[model samples]
Target chain A: MSVLDSRRGGGNGNNDDLASLEAGLDALETHLDTRASRWRKLLSATWPPVLAIVGLLGVWELIYRSGVKPTYALPSPADVGLVLRDQLSDGTLLEAMGTSLTRGGLGFLAALAIGTPLGLLIARVRPIRRGIGPLVSGLQSLPSIAWVPAAIIFFGIGDAAIYAVVLLGATPSIANGMVSGIDQIPPLYQRVGKVLGARGLSAARHVLLPAALPGYVGGLRQGWAFSWRSLMAAELIVHSPELGQGLGQLLDFGRSNNDMSLVFAGILGILVVGIAVELCVFAPLERRVLRRRGLLVARS
Target chain B: MTVLEEQRVTRSTGAVSLRGLTKRFGDGPNVLEDVSLDVAEGEFVCLLGASGCGKSTLLNLVAGLDRPSAGSVHVPGGRAALMFQEPALLPWLTATQNVELALRLRGVGKSERRVRSNELLELVRLSGAGGKRVHELSGGMRQRVAMARALAQDSHVLLMDEPFAALDAITRDVLHEELVRIRESQQLTVLFVTHNVREAVRLGDRVVLLSSRPGRVAKEYPVGIAHPRRIESPEVARLSVEITDDLRTEIRRHGAH
Candidate 1:
């Protein structure tokens, strides 16, 4: 056919060049700023959040300097900064941060371990879904603080109690996140999977799980928040010397001693760590998933 | 309610035979009733109907995605590969990986999978775009990749349910040409379903129109026009107009008591 076309001198030789050129043009138009001067995009995306944070700190400093409240009641930004500096220098704050982060990390890991399989079972098993679907949703609305007393009763007021509270708080959100994620997947994906002979476990692995990722990511973020909050709440309520000083313990100690700056420092510590985890761990994961799927619109 | 039984047939067998195929969903009226058709090896058959017609249900029955209430759907060359209107590529997978996923399910091995996946991508004219994610592809490209994924199943029969119905006219024309070229080169038996008259006449060797409300074969036109047929050509237009008239009458009858 190629020889005949070439002999006739009319068919595909010129059309091939034209087709390639058309493909090139299509590629150019559909290109979505990948691997081409990406750093510029990164910098542009980063600046606004940085500036807003700096502005927030500036306003806090100005209000303190205006002498709006008693110095004891409202510590100056400098005083909090000094407290931060002192804690770093003495290594006590570092130790507390280490302790609290360890607890939060362990608790979140435990929740992930337990919650993922539970969520899968809840999502896939019809009888269990019918029985416990509402129960899981109900558990999500119950504040993690409410679990503190029950945890204290079940596990006698130590690290075990804290761990128990964190698990109770985080597991439901993770499980429910996955449930909703599986629910939201378009039926088209599963049909495609089946036609391609992906059934049962293969269908769940290839189609359902990956399709449900965006919602699962949302659940993970919520799960982390609940775990962190529950851990802190448990720490504040049960202050045994054997458990070491977490930020929550420091805040509790500050309340007892009337050290407002210390309390302020602890609150700041909590906020910073939460933001760091979100930025460092989960935000990048969510962004990658969304960007790969073109669900995330690139920031201008 | 016959299970899809494996029949020992010689290789190079190229026909799908449906004998008294009927389907009904739970106590509702029959979705497809007593539909019988035979498409030869390397034949292009288009199943045309209105929206509510059970054209899709018939395709699903042949593809083994749906069970018929009665009768038989025998694709002599084995299970027909199916393509939907949507690309339905897994977003986590790149275009090549989407095709590769199909191959992998067929138990193709690692090194061979990569080589075969690249070959399939090239067949769809998406050789360079294999690295791109599904979302990054244009609508036309995604559908082409879907065609590639469907083809990757390596089945003798291909069942497509309005695969190109979603594309704009220009892109649709280009893909129509691509599909015909591939069908000829591969000698595949195709059972394509569409509501579009021009599309049916343009691609099919035999255009089979199904009536709505328990879809059954209403009419059949054997297209004698030579290949490398253009969708905009006069031959396609003349046939499309005649078929469209019949289709309109069929649809209007559905509204009557």
Candidate 2:
């Protein structure tokens, strides 16, 4: 029997019409996701990471309660939390965070400015790339933290030293990232680019840069890490009144005062800032790039 | 001798011409030798040969993607559009945007690019698929998008190197038909490379057969069949069989060494 005939209830046109209407509605509703349903799907996929983070927190609380170490050696999690609260109430923590973030951001920007052209030159010009390719890779392999002592000596223990170390640390990563980005581009793209009349600077701007964005962005992320680490090392070693109090200084203060809780709080503050920048700025930037290229998939 | 000179004269009028063209890697024997030919305006020619016949090398020379070791190559009409066996679509671009990139490079205005790209996509029977990314497309659809991108340049000549070789039989047949329709409608000049004798006969006005190893033009067939010719037609089958026989002979000669 036909779907309409089968749906007909015994001597009841109203019920039969209702049944057909319900079936049609069901068909229409198929593949449509309500907001709640979409959220449920997202939660299922994300739950594992959430649970692991909670488990880590639970372990920290347990260790603190068990008094694994003397309170002076490693304060309880509650003590650390108390330090964080005090700093927050006094606004010192936020101020220190702002100072560190500003320095890191500026250093990262400077590195990008220097590294991008260096990368493009290495990628496009054979002699230049050959000469500097090995050097860039070598520099990237060199620890940025190693630059701290030299920077202090050269720049005299202040913001200048911090910036110098940050620059040295970050530049190589950015340049190397760009080199990889350029290398990964398919040769076919170059051919197509040339045929389409893209050459010289115009070609670099329109084709090469966009194609290499993922790799370049990856480099930028590494550069930021380098900048942050170098700046912190510099701030810890070089103390000056002219240099405003920052996370690194706070960390130094906690160490000198033998305040383990303050040290833990400072460490947590650094971690939070780094993750926040990546999430709010770089992560979104990368996601937008991938999404524009249709490379992003909904987790669900 | 006069006929050869006349052929040379006719070739000189074409957008692309290759004269005594030969290539070799290092001290090896020539991959192509004395390959003198001219593609007249709006001519649809096919380079038919088995693997290692240097068909791609010749097309590359014509495209200026590579250089010939001997003789000369010329493109009287700027850069030619090249279509490879693979679609070679940019993974980052949508089907429409890919075509638009060609136009954008050609100095087309932003407003004009969108319309032109859409038009080209429609030309390839891929209307409403401009938003589809390259990887999302099927092999045939990708090739068609590739074709649209090639066409976006408005180049006088198109060099295709086994563009349909990887597709299924049905898809290839469909594309072959689509190509004929587009070629006729646009008055496009095509230099198609393929090993399929039937494809060579079906698509080309002239088919140049090349021998293997130290490739040279073994034979040339002038396909007199009209547009929309059927594969099952007596003329197409006859030419296919003849070309296949020549190709077989060339292969057997290579084996004797």
Candidate 3:
């Protein structure tokens, strides 16, 4: 086709100048840093979750006022609020939260220390990956509640029993995270790493780990859930005077005393803490990693 | 022996020597049958043929991405870096980091890597693209980044496997000029692989045609054309037609029982 008729983008300019202009335009327009505008973007992104929480509270208030059951069976939202207020005023709520947080935190840290390397080993070495891969999945599927009885027998109903349960619950998730992360890494990236002389330890450190990070982070989130659940289970099932009373103990105590409002408060506290940690910690950490690599998209 | 050690011994300037280079795949038919060719130091050589002619297989052997089944292949550099048809830059890294990665692997010091990566990027005329991610770049820009990445290896020999095959004609033309400029400036020994006879004629100082399946070198033509030879030029067209005729005969031979 003649130059005049061959117009892709119009205006019959000099070919060299036009080519350079087109190249510059292509470079500028398709560039990676198309981040949203600051304040408005953040506000828009946060509105949905904020609204959901408010709507949930409204529903709870509505259910409370309906008076569908006896107070012993289903306490009103106001009754639960009163218990929460009393616990907060007395400092018991803080103490229980601290106790549970310490146990879960310690267990998770230990799981991370043990499980990350174990998972890397399992992911990298073919024999170990095959041998223990299925077993790890099996462990993940087994509930932390089921471990409480065996753990008590093994460690005799003390801190050891609690820790044993936590270990059983959290380790699988951390290891599975590493395995899945490693598995999810594209073959091309590995090949590129190899081409770049990234062999053995260097490859794992620079390419494999970073490439597999998203999956590993996913694993950590799941592992935290397991750690939290297992610690609560242990606290409920294996009671000891030496061990400080935690959220789980408070929950059990509330149930025994037939204080349904206090029981609802404990349940709400656990859920609120879980959701809070996920939203405030893991979600931000994950978004930063994904955003740096230009993989993150605003959640609708 | 490693391709690097072989390169050093033959490093009388810029020359690639492959002797009795036979290759096979796991008890199967030989892919390359006792093939041998010598590419002069500072010469742009294109291995021209149709698919399964073992053109890429030869390039891989020379690149040290693979080893030949038998015989010796020597590039001037102990290590010869490669550019694939696809711009295989790491998606996670920006253009500069992709190039710097090669320098990093080569044990280039942390202080020197940035300087060297920038220099190489500038050499490819992508000076200001240090911070650009691979996915953000256009097709031609991506190839230039790939070129920069390959050059970062600082090897004497550069093996390219159809590096411009995926590009549009205009971009490919621009890159052809860029390649010639880079080769002239750097005094690089390029072992380029392509099925496009016109591209072969346009780019190479010499074109080596390979016969199909169990590929062997069928003919070698020294283009004798000056640099910046257009694809439409009479010499380029004449040589391209000659190479195409040879390539067709090889394909016809494959069909003749």
Q: Put down candidate 3 lDDT per residue, B128-201, tens digits, no spaces.
A: 77898876688888898999888888876888999999988878887886686677567678899999999999
DockQ of each: 0.37, 0.12, 0.20
Q: Is the docking of candidate 1 incorrect, acceptable, medium or high quality?
A: acceptable
TM-scores computed on chain B for all candidates: 0.93, 0.93, 0.93
The number of the candidate with the highest TM-score is 1
Better of 1 and 3 by TM-score: 1
Q: C-alpha displacement of B199 in model 2, angstroms?
A: 1.8
Give one digit per residue, the lDDT tens place, for model 1 in A1-300: 321122112257644754675486457547666553768877977999999988988998888889998888888778888988987899977788888999999999999999888898899899999999899889989888888888888888799989998999999999998999999999988999999999888888888899999999999999999999998898899788787899899899999999998888888888888889999999999999898888998554
Q: List the residue pairs that clash in candidate 3.
A: B4-B78, B14-B41, B15-B41
For residues A22-134, what per-residue lDDT tens digits would candidate 2 score against the true structure? 33432443333334576787788688989998888789888877987877986667778888999999999999999999998998899999998898888878999889889
Rank the models by lDDT, top first. 1, 3, 2
Tens-digit lDDT track of model 3 for A194-281: 7667888888877899899989999999999999999988898778678898889989999899989888888877887788889898
Task: Give candidate 1's fnat, 2 decimals.
Answer: 0.44
